[model samples]
Target: MNIHVSYPSRLYSDKLSLDCGSTRICHDISVAIPDRGFTVIIGPNGCGKSTLLRGLSRLVRPSAGKVHLDGKVISDYSTREVAQRLGLLPQSAQAPEGIRVGELVSRGRFPYRRAFSTWSDEDERAVLAALQATSTLELIDREVDTLSGGQRQRVWIALALAQETPVLLLDEPTTFLDIAHQIELLNLLRNLKETGNRTLVAVLHDLNHACRYADHLIAMRDGRILFEGSPAEIITPSNIEALFGLRCVVISDPVSGTPLVVPR
Candidate 1:
């Protein structure tokens, strides 16, 4: 299979450690996200995958080490500055009561708008483009609380896309979706990579899906990276068994010709 290489992007972590209360999730892990590509993190439950993602997105402060964006420490930038550069669509995001789809998406422009400055045409275009891209334009007038799980996910993605950040991070974006919706979301994510200027990272539980959609696959276990490389190189049966403790056969996907993992 053919794979493309890209430069490292804004997000990177060195010796990163994260804690949940007194328990540490990960320790001394390092990562560099390639610029403008799709990178997926996969691992078993309770393996600190989500915690690692949280650290990268600045939702969880590192107990040790550091996360950097654009070769600078992330903490040096103000919250708004970080927001302008990195966008995160957290798992199971909730919308406010009575908030319309358009209203929820419009919030993405908050970092760009000053307290005294009114919303501009550019903001409107961004929101509209985001809605259209996610196929949520028809739902613009609908209340977010009334949408289905799949529909809500699309809307949330649109909200993130409206942020127009260079790096976007998602945590299990397919968690609650049915098979069709899961495929829909993955295809949408693949299309986002076509721009070749936006970086995408996601934590996924499905090894097959990760192999299919990821340009770079990170297999983590016990808060450490067991393997990191192109899916073609990283999705071996040995890596799959190590990551999930599952004996599996790795084959070429009939559709995409990417690595396909089938558990025995």
Candidate 2:
């Protein structure tokens, strides 16, 4: 759908905190993400990066404070209504066994469909576009269970892309890939950013990849934001130490010219 949509403004959390059962994963945190850029969330393990992303996507309800999507309270939106505007690829997603790639991708059209309605021409076009965008068109007939780790990951991304949401959230998308596949996936996401007015928020484990691919970076520590800005402004030895408790040297990436970090 080529709708004339305004790029969503920065998502804001007003003193957001999350309680998973009894444990507090994220504390009172407030931050505004940019509207039309790739924003990566980084920190040491258990620093609440994924939790924060979940809160932003409204997948996990917050214990305190509120999350605002374009000034509207996120909790106020219906599930399908929210899905129409924001898509999320969680850290680990399980596809039904033996499902074909095309079928799986077509499921992304659910939010855009009326209850009990069949797929439409627009849905087919979207599924096709997503498969093409992720370079998975050739695998459409293949069973998702038979694909390699990288290919499966791409298929998952294609599903999200098929949703055609303005805001995309990914949680550690490169987790199972080798170095080359990791770079490939990051490059694909960068290309998607260039192709439209999309807002990407990814929880990334690799500090270097986050710095190189993200237009903006949010460094979290102990459930609070340690820093947020362009890579040049947020990535530094001191910032690294504060976020990950590591001493690292930050340099410029020869290819992307963004920050490149190496641990001591």
Candidate 3:
């Protein structure tokens, strides 16, 4: 069966700037996120990738400019309304001690519930589906602290999935995972993008993985976007060098025919 999904119009920033106290992190940044694609943001550490992600999610109010969601100012929407349309997974998410996996994931449904309404069948279905999709259904009753790093990461992702939003933003989702787990998580994200008409945005450190899995790439440097395009168009050695100030060898992945970067 074919399912038709309606996504909010692409989100974009106009002359966006971010400041924390007296420090300026991002400046005059403007870019449009595609309506339905996996877009990876890559850059050197402390280059404002995370800041930009926060701005996009409305977690950080921009110092200047505005973020538009579906042609409407994002700050104008009610918090619950925005939550129902967008979900953000930060790099470091801590579950309360002794929290059960199911209970942790169920929090994502909060936006769908009225203040005094009890959990309904639809909420239960969404929670179960998210757990199953992330392959964490079997761990539903387990304490989050007992899971491996990879498993815990999946649980967090499941929580975001349970939100059932059209726009999903992840900040450094593979931060603490080993190589195998990193690949696993990336593959899971790829599967999620393919299975639904959703837009996935992630801050990725591994350029090769970003190129391989992302349909679009946004390269940033020193708080500014250096380039934004398809992996094939933006993953050249010159671009990589400009973005990360590193010399690298760029080659094609044998399986996916995407660019692979070998740092020099």
Candidate 4:
């Protein structure tokens, strides 16, 4: 494996803490998600993996410290300004009743629109390109509520891509997906990163998938980050145990040649 030295980081945390109501879900987590890379955060349920991701996305306010975007504190930016630089795909998207795919995707252009402004040609082109990229162009006229799980997910990704941000974050994008859809989504994300369209950060539950696709990996447990590095450096048996509390043997995946964890 080549040492994947990161580009200058644009999104990072400085001793950030996240809260769910009055209960703290994450402790002080100072971490950097490398720019223009595919980074996967993995840990057991309730370990604050998604909480940390939400903080980075500014979907949740940091209870302590800060998240930085482009070397500036993210909170300093206006909501629309932040939306122009970053996009987020939550675990499950709730589309309006009977909303068509195209209409839902067009919402991504909200950051660029002025009050009562007409949708620009650039917005049209972006929405079209995003639909094509996700292979959902044919579904543009279809209602979002009428699509299958896989199809809906692709449409949701198209919506995010339409935003045209330099950074994108996903919270367990594969949740409730079958194996085939999960692979499809991961492959799409990898392609997004490889094409230099955006920096990718995802919270994932599957350790093997994280190892297979991540250029960098973060492991968390008990509301704190425990380890972070390239998968080859961080997916050792001991680290696996520390993060997931399972004894496992780590081996090279025959297909991708990334680390594969086999629990004993």
lDDT of 3 at 14: 75
Off by over 4 Å in 3: 1-9
**TM value for model 2:** 0.94
Q: What is candidate 1's lDDT per residue for 1-264, written digit by digit as tens? A: 112224455788878899999998987788888778899998899999899989998999999989999878998999999999999988757789999999999999999999899989999999999999899999999999899988999999999999999899999999979999999999999898885378999998877888888998877888888878999987888878877889989889999999998889
The per-model lDDT (C-alpha) reads 0.89, 0.88, 0.91, 0.90
Compared with the true structure, the alpha-carbon lDDT of candidate 1 equals: 0.89
Per-model TM values vs. the true structure: 0.95, 0.94, 0.95, 0.95
Report each candidate's C-alpha RMSD, comma-separated, in the order given. Answer: 3.2, 4.8, 4.9, 3.0
Model 3 lDDT on a 0 to 1 scale = 0.91
Give the clash count for each candidate. Answer: 0, 0, 0, 0
Model 4 off-target regions past 4 Å?
1-8
Per-residue lDDT of candidate 2, residues 1-264 (tens digit):
111123446577878899888999888887777887899999989889999999999988999988888669998889898898889999778999999999999998889998788879999999999999999999999999999999999999999999999999999999989999999999999999989678899998898888888988988887778778888997988888877788989988999888898899
The residue pairs in collision within model 4 are none
Candidate 4: clashing residue pairs, number: 0
Give residue 53's error in model 3 in angstroms: 0.2
